[model samples]
Target chain A: MNNVYLYNDSFNELISLIFYLLKNNIKPTNIKDVSYNPNLFEECIFLGIKSKEQDINNIALQFGYYAFRCIYYVYLSNNESKELIIYYFILNAIKYRKKITYMRNLKCVHETLRIAEYVSHETHKMKGFTRFKEINNNILYAEIEPVNNILELVSKHFEKRLKNEYWIIKDVQRRLFSVYDKKNFYIIPEENLKLEDFRISKEEKEIKEMWQLFYKTIGIKERKNDRCRMNFMPKRYWKYLIEMEDEL
Target chain B: MELKEKLKILADSAKYDASCSSSGSNRTSKNGLGNTAIAGICHSFASDGRCISLLKILMTNCCIFDCKYCLNRKSNNIKRAIFTPEEICEITINFYRRNYIEGLFLSSGIIKSPDYTMELMIKTITLLRNKYHFGGYIHAKAIPGASEILLRKLGSLVDRLSANIELPTENGLKLLAPNKDSNKVDKIMSYVKEKQNRKFVPAGQSTQMIIGATKESDLDIMSKSSSMYDNYKLKRVFYSAYIPINKDNLLPTLEKPPLVRENRLYQADWLLRYYNFKVNDLLNENNPNFNILVDPKTDWALRNIELFPKEINKCSYYDLLKIPGIGVKSAQRILKARRNFTITFDELKKLGVVLKRAKYFITCNGKYFMSSSYFKKEFIEANIVLEDKSIENTKIEQLGLFNE
Candidate 1:
């Protein structure tokens, strides 16, 4: 009989489920997220436990801190089988201790690292691809549609850089917003955000026009290659990029 | 003129310069509006496929010299515009706040004198730094023939300082840009190298050399680049293809820039910097130019085929990097993955190694990945993918705006 374990969508919930299964000595054949559909051959077990911070820290202490981070980052990805991958990766980590991360030949460990890398790579790219517009000449607002749950990671970067300004980063894919108010930042679900209320400041149009002109003027006419431009800045990003809007 | 018109004129004049990197400086925001990430960030890509990291522009298009190849030469019949110090700071702050740019890259044509021009640039950066409290990346051009005092002051204010060599050889400079003294360029590079403190030009210095303009071969250009890196510890050396902008007795007329040669030179430059290969290893007196048919590394690997079929599990990190199609990251991955289990040929692809080019060069437990019939140089040569062949086929002539 295949025993399947299920958990809620957050990283903390996943950690709590892993801790419960490990403590009870129950080996899960398939780990399914709450949104996943179970097969007829699998016996599902749902552990709706709100895990403590100490439990997560204990897992980090047992498996190395980097291994814990890799699992956390992989949890942020949109992979369907990510929970099973994490469960198998945790089993390997418990056996091999800190050395399991270097074993890329292991299927579970390789997928865990690869998925974690994809999440961080998207976060890095969003650092440059995120464009902001001034709203009411006071608050800065930008929108992103990343495939992973990296909105919080990107907000942490801007929190250090634009500390003095009020900013909001909206993850359109996840329907969440990371709002910063000069002192700190907080991530909240899109509750009552009126899309029409987000208006561009008076001088914003002029500055954007000037930027578009500068963008066009800087490219050499002799070296004009749309293929090359698309290679660096992919086509999926063109929808939100102000400079690429005209071409789209 | 309006600010928009001034920006267009200055940006057009500054487009010839190929140094657009805003990396290697890490200044956090402390009581300021911006900060510089050490790894740098490219905000946009221009239609030409080049990264637009900084708001690259000239302070003024008006000049005192008539360099035949420059668009902002004194003899050119173009509209001249200059920005005040306050105006540049305002533009930089606004653009940075909106995330339109990572920082500012300010270069200018010599207005009154070299020292005078350098002083004006220093004033602009100082205002941006102190008055506005802008802590973004700033890459400023170190004006040739400027005084050491002025150079020192500008170096402290900016993140990176670069002096353009303009041409590859001294004779090329004499023929095209007679007003530019190549020795003065060397003096600025040495000054930055000497004053290599934490606060003085924290990102280090770099230089750019125009390719395909003069009669210098790829060997000569790579040799000069190798020596510059050895001598001055430059962060990077940019290679800009000579676009046919000037029609003079000394300049050669062409349909378009020799972009293929520029691409090849950049490939060889990467091999010198990262792959631990010398200029001589890639090119000798017998073979002066890179094979336009294949990349420099692949060309070397094909020539030195006796060292092939390196055992993937047994080779050192340095030997793994020597194999074609395996980059630094993949080689390190191989090293890490091999410690746990022996890597099979199928698993090599999963470990980030490009198997198409690497199959002929590497082995999995002393067994070749591909059949022995495909091990010949002619087979690999026929199958190797060309990245930019279409760039050579399409021919278009851009009308000369500066050198007309």
Candidate 2:
């Protein structure tokens, strides 16, 4: 069968393009995996579906940028329909463009910014509500798989709050980790491994113990407003928060 | 005694204050140390179900003044504990490291004098920020009658600051908290507002006024709150419905707090800030308090029925926001969706607008749907759910109790 490349009038067919190139026994090595050969002796007769893999990769990467911009636009507008429209727009933008700079036009950029604002706002809200707990291994582990790409935004919050310690914020849905040592933060991609298998420091245990003690002491019995508590820190996030598990 | 025991006592005493927000101020890590998230963190919940992120504790439960409404009022017999500045700082830093708290909300009773209590509070904040490098959010209360220098010093270090307005009026303050002066509290608030103007307390100032204490009508309370907002540029005005914990001749003996009243006030406050509603719009001489049956917005809409059935296409964003249950989000959604197609009642529901309330005030295709006949008796009957017995009876009815 001919390569099954799904194409829309708008150029958002990068995944389909990858699928087609791989299906045709072609390994994408450079940006020319599906390029037309100009030096062919019979140009009119020959339909070259061959291009450098790098070219395909570059085009795919460019489309990724356009897609991200479109998603951001939908986010700022808080328009669910804009989400579908953005997908169509990016698909079209990619099919027609080779240069990354050409995709960074005003219209695409503006839409991306609007979505970014909304996504960023929600991410910020999650940062406040995301609670962490200490386990036996001494790792200050917080698990929040937020609806948006808020890993970086939330990681910064954990880094600042837990400044003088080591912690890991795991996005369980994405299977990504924003790990922070006393010094800096770095992202860890999921490698089909459990977090418990990872190494933890002894000092982390002492800090966790101290923290649990502090958390236990601060709550006042007379002032408990369960409805308000649930309003601010929803039960959906209880699994990751160490102290909330027993209470919940 | 152990630190845990002291913390329990202090937190219990502090819980009644009821302002536990951590938002405002965006602090990030610079010295490879702590950072502040603009979205504040709530680490845990108390028995009453409030989020406990900050180590919300008073320095001491010992008070000289006899505030009749207060649990820790000097005459009330309760266990009192005072934490040294070092103890508070250590607990705050430790809790913060474990990701249990965003920072400290250190309040205190008048341990000796307002100045001395304020000084110790200031010292605790200074130690946390400078010694511990605690760049996390700090919400410190400005002690009424505390020296101006102390208030200014505390304001410079903390992220958000508040001075409890305590009561709606001077007469209420006199009757409920005899020693506390309304003008003195206003003076402190003004000081906080001035410091906020001078680049201190970057989150601006907020104040709490106790509701249902001394017979101040909802109109009196809301008007004071409105003026506080207008003059102070206050970040928030928190309304805590008074729960009479201590028996006092001065205060009313109520079984439970007027929670519905508090809820109505919050709704009214939202209208004030976002819906361009004035205090007078919600209340006047004829309607001194919010109607218990319906929300303030719906009540206002019902009273001013002439504004109903506004054209969705022609109505400005502000005008669309006037409809009950159409908040900022739904209004914006309506604006965007209408750009692509004309919005019908069905489409409006899909856009997340509350049709039950909006049905009375809005229309589609210039055709009125909600008539007085549909809502006249049913709406009044529907609102009887706010009554205590009706709710209890409904609960019993749900459990299949027909004979009784």
Could you say which candidate leads in TM-score? 1
| CA-lDDT, candidates in order | 0.88, 0.69
lDDT per residue (tens digit) for residues A1-248 in model 2? 22222223112344344334445545332211123233433222222334445644554476566444444434334343343344344444555443322222234433454466667666655665565555545567778867676787777766656666667887888788888877798887888445665555565556555445545554544444555566656677666666664565
CAPRI classification of candidate 1:
medium
> B294-372 in candidate 1: lDDT tens per residue?
7888999988988886899999888898898888889988998888889899788777677867887888987886676
TM-score, model 1 to reference: 0.94
Give candidate 2 misplaced runs (Cα > 4 Å): A1-86, A89-139, A143-153, A156-164, A171-176, A181-184, A189-236, B44-49, B336-340, B369-404
Please give the lDDT score for candidate 1.
0.88
